[model samples]
Target: MSKHFLRPPGAVAEADFLGRCIRCGKCALACPYRAIRVAGLLDGLEIMGTPVILARKSPCYLCLKCVPVCPSGALESRVKKREQVRMGTARLNRKECLNWQGTFCRSCYDHCPLFNEAITMDGELRPVVNEKKCVGCGICEHVCPADPAAIIVTPRGAG
Candidate 1:
């Protein structure tokens, strides 16, 4: 066996797996919390249409959003945390969310003292990110009204 194994059983093959992804955007679509973002055709060859590049922006929490929609099996279903970690840190579960249904909830957005730090608003009145401003704080995760918390934080990982 190779002593330097690339991924643990639950680890994500971010580069290869993402490269193989068909750009279906299903992972981004299925995410009730909208945590995973499927890129467009021109973002970059490395990340175009694949799951959000954890490095260019934020990191992924353990929400497993991209894992479920990978029809091509490009994205692995399981990965040990020790095996890989991506760049971006704020992640949302969506399964336990109050915002997915369009309810009036802003616990996560409200408690974020650094309004422009980790989260921001779009013209549509939803939270958009100033990626450069984010500090990867877990305050949004702590204040989320969702049971599992629609949003959470992930540790910095090797993108």
Candidate 2:
């Protein structure tokens, strides 16, 4: 336990970003993947109530277990990819970002399958997602450390 293994992944949503968090811990208990947690109040944050953090031990396979049962609208699903409704914009939480703090962790980069396009490692070594290249799979969001998640997915809006 020297290091924090899990973290909040990108591809989650703001409205769905713990917006409906009820502090019930039901999401924590329901997570079969064990990606979610209740770590009380963390630093650099003002969690309204019980703070549920997503520990990225294992990456999300897109099973979407915690989405349906959310008592609050905390985990609303948004459409992204028109092909199969599997893609959207992935947002990130710079406040909790270890990379943003000059750390050397690129878990999301390693986990993301999209290479040479979706996730680009900047000169600073931080993973930067290409919105156009991103498919909005929600895999990153599900594995994020932030309770509401730094990065989240949003529905693709028609222009």
Candidate 3:
């Protein structure tokens, strides 16, 4: 299965999401962060016109705007907290991380919306992820100075 792709916040399981989605572009238009995008022809017929978030391009800020605009119930409309939105999980590649090599960088932790809850510092000041607390929003991945990004957010099922 392709675990790398993610649905928006409050999205149902993949099979159900694909079935219920009506291919409308409301969700994408409603997003203030412009994090949501409609799948292109290259994405395949099953996902065309469906809203998708490409975290590396633009991370969802959990503004919850896209949720209510999903008329077909592809995305549940009532999420009240950042912790309730599970887009994916962030993983750290220690070998490529500047902090792991003692450069004193905390870009991922600083950019994380969950901050201390999802990412904490160890005694060495290296960022540690609390997987359960991470919503996989991808802000950490976007802000990393590393060429390949030391921190990567994987879609929920992908990991």
Best by lDDT: 3
lDDT of 3: 0.85
Order the numbered candidates by TM-score, best leading: 3, 2, 1
Each model's TM-score?
A: 0.39, 0.44, 0.93
Candidate 3 lDDT score at position 74: 85
lDDT of 2 by residue, 55-154 (tens): 2344434445555556665555442222222335566667766677676667667766565466778888876878877665556665555555666655
Clashes per model (N, Cα, C within 3 A): 9, 22, 0
Best by TM-score: 3
Better of 2 and 3 by TM-score: 3
Q: Show the lowest summed lDDT stretch of 10 residues, model 2.
A: 2-11
Task: Report lDDT (Cα) of residue 46, candidate 1.
Answer: 56
lDDT of 3 at 146: 88
* Candidate 1 per-residue C-alpha lDDT over 78-98 given as tens digits, one digit per residue, 9 for 90 to 100: 433422323335665555656
Steric clash pairs (candidate 1): 10-78, 10-79, 10-80, 11-79, 11-80, 58-88, 59-88, 59-89, 85-157
**What residue runs in model 2 are displaced by over 4 Å at the alpha carbon?**
1-86
For model 3, how does the per-residue alpha-carbon lDDT over 1-159 read when each residue is reduced to its tens digit? 133556789888788888999988898899988898889878887787787887777888888888888888888876767789988888999999999988999888898888799999999899999998999888888889988888888877765
